[model samples]
Structure formats: structure tokens, C-alpha cells
Target: MSIALAAISILHLLDLVILITSTAANAWIVDGDLSADLWYKCTSKNGGYHCKQSINEDWLQAVQALMVLAVLFCLLSFVFFLCQLFTLVKGGRFYFTAVFQILASLFVMSGAIIFTVMNYAAASSSYGYAYVLAWLAFPLTLGSGLIYIILRKTE
Candidate 1:
């Protein structure tokens, strides 16, 4: 039981880390020497790199907000899990934590889907690390949330 609990906690932490990194890293699209992310587009100029605000689009803004919300909800879920772990009686389910985590997963999925459908500028460029990471975090978070939903406190 202890080992399983520790593993779940670790997976949750990993999902949180991936969510943060994916949302913040500037690599959503990669072109020859240019890259773009949620917040900025960076291009390599003669011996240097220049970064500017990302394209102003409604969908892009929606993706940005969703990613941020996902990260926040994920963090909150973990905190709730810790609090519940100590306060809940044996056999109590971590429903609050599971809900938050599941919502986080949904937010991530929504953001990624929006990007996939709306990102026109990047049609020529290849998807970058941040894009891949966002997709990766989605399943991990969902799995963690499902694990929490089915898990019960045990001595």
C-alpha cells in the first residue's frame, strides 16, 4: 500500500512538472531557425535570437488560459490529496483530488485540441517539444486522476 501510494504521488508530481514545462517552454512550433510558443516567438538572427509576443489570436489566448488553469488545478489537486491523506478516515476516497485532476486533464486536452485545429501559421513548421509535452501530460494526468478516483485510504 505504501509503495502504491508513493508511486501515485510520484506520477502526479511528474504530470505537474510536464504541464508546467509544456506551457512555458518556447517550442510549440519549429521552423528553420524560428520557434514559437504560447507566449513568444523566437527567431535566430545573425549571431543572436529575438523573441516577441506570440500571435494575437482568440484561440491562442484560449489555449494559454486553459494551460494555465490546468497547471493550477493540478497543483491544487496534489495539495488536496496531501491534506486528505492525513485528515480523511480510513477507506475514504479522494474524490476532491480526483475531480481536480480530471479537470486538469480535460483542460489540457482542450488546449491541445484547439491548437491542433487553429494553428495555421505553424502548418509549415514541425511540432516542437512543448507541443509533444502537452499531449504527453494529458494522458498521464488522466491516468493519475483515474487512479485517485478508484483509490481508497488504507492503513
Candidate 2:
């Protein structure tokens, strides 16, 4: 059993978990940021922020649902990766497994970048480390992905 292969799988799992957490956390961040703005804007007049205590329940719920689904997908992806990794250990080329793994990383990086851009000013209020891990993880994820592709069996 190649230790490096298992390590790669573990790293993939870790990235998957991070993606799930990032998704779920994004919902809270969005709600919190919006809620805080609403709170202050309610007190401060003159069209400063235009926030209200009674925010859009539908939008909030929708975002929450999206977060749940995103997390679920990430979890499922990890599970599938584990199964695939076990099979690859026995005798299998890193095929779709690597592709999916890379895709997951891409998803999270894109999500992080998008969130950072969307909440650019949130730093003043909250929304910390918008592009922190994504920036670092992107290249690592991409490099690992390329390694997997090159290591894959041609047959």
C-alpha cells in the first residue's frame, strides 16, 4: 500500500470537510452580516444602510437550504472518495476519483473567491478570511489534481 496515495485521499477528505464547513458558515455569515446591518440601519436613519429588523425570511431560509445541500454534497463526495480510494489501493487507476476531487476543490475556491468579492466591505463589520484558505488551497488542490492525472493508468 502506497502511503502517499492514502495521504492524498485523506487530504481530499479534509478539503471536502472544509468545503462543507465553508458552505454552512457562509449562510451564517450572510445572515449575520445582513442582520447586523439591518439592526444598525434600523436605528440610524437617512438611508444609510436601509436595513430592517424584519428581514426577508424567504431569502434567509433559501440560503440556509442551499448551505445544507452544499454540505450534504461535500459529505457525499468524501464518502465516495473513500470508497474509490480503497478500490484504487487494491488495483485501480485514479480516474474519476481524481476528477471529482479536483472539482470539489474548484468549487470551494470559487465559492470563497465569490464570497470574498461579494462581501468585500464586510471586513469592517465581520466576514473575516474571505479568500484566506481558498487562495492557498487552490494551487495545492490544482497541483494534486495534476499529479493524479499524470499518475493515472493509461490503459
Candidate 3:
């Protein structure tokens, strides 16, 4: 259980890094200059769609901040799980940890979905494979939450 949760934590951190990089192109305080833009363009091509974007710097930053908070919440939930693993009985309040995780995952997913939809609405643009990883994250997170529920009440 610990190993599984640890792996999940690591994956969550990695996803956060990717999410941050994806936003780098339009950071208000860290403008995605020409070189950075080119990098995004190149990497994006590998992902099955044009990854390059022209987002409003402030909007991009705002989105990043929101997602970061979501990730932090996930981390917090994991921390709670860790505490319970060490101190609680097998089934004591596991549901609470799972509930927090589920809520956090839902928030992150909604944010990502909203961001994608808004991006399309703003520019009528399409996203490609780079988004696959993000899309993949949603289910993984949800799965984790479900795992907690399954494990709950187990002797």
C-alpha cells in the first residue's frame, strides 16, 4: 500500500512538472520567447498535434497557479494517507483520505477540462498528443481514488 501510494505521489509530481512546462510558453513573468516557443513547437509535433500555442501570458499563469493548487491538495491527501497508514487501524477513516483524494482529483480534472475548452473557445485551436498525458492523468487519479475505496474496510 505504501509503495503504491508513493508511486502515485511521484507520478503526481511529474505530472505537475509537465503541467508547468506546458504553461511556460505564456508565463506572464517568464515569457515564452522565441527559443522557448520553438521548443514547444518541436516537442508538440512529436505528440501527434501542434503543441505550440499563443496563450495570453496572464491567463496561462493563472491556469498554472490554479492547477498547482490542485496538485498541492493531492499531495496533502497523500500525506494524510501516509499518516493513517502509520497510526490508524486497517480501516479506520480510510474513507476520509479517499474522499479528499477524490475531491482533489475532481478539482484538477475540472480545471484541466475547463482550460482546454476555454483555450479552444478563445482561439478555435486544436490540441494533440501532449494532451494525451494530461488526459491520461485524469483516469489514473480517479483510479487511485477508487483503489482507496476498495481498500477501505479491508481487514
| Full-model lDDT for every candidate | 0.96, 0.49, 0.54
How far out, in Å, is residue 62 in model 1? 0.2
Order of all candidates by TM-score, from best down to worst?
A: 1, 3, 2
Every model: Cα RMSD to truth: 0.9, 7.5, 7.3
Q: Candidate 1: which pairs clash?
A: none
User: Compared with the true structure, what per-residue lDDT tens digits does model 2 show for residues 33-140?
Assistant: 243321122333454545444344454344334434444554555566556655665345666655755665565555555444444345435542423444455565
TM-score: the better of candidates 1 and 3: 1
State the weakest 10-residue window (summed lDDT) of model 1: 116-125
Indicate the TM-score of model 3: 0.58
Among all windows of 10 consecutive residues in model 2, the one with the lowest summed lDDT is 35-44
Q: Between 1 and 2, whose TM-score is larger?
A: 1
Better of 2 and 3 by TM-score: 3
For candidate 1, lDDT tens digit of each residue in 33-97? 99999999999989999999998989999999999999999999999999999999999999999
List runs of model 3 lying over 4 Å from the truth: 1-62, 121-130, 153-155
Per-residue lDDT of 15-76 in model 3, one digit per residue for the tens?
45554443343321221222222123323233353345445565445555656665666677
Can you tell me which runs of candidate 1 are displaced by over 4 Å?
none
- Flag the better candidate by lDDT, 1 or 2: 1
Would you list the rank order by lDDT, best first? Answer: 1, 3, 2
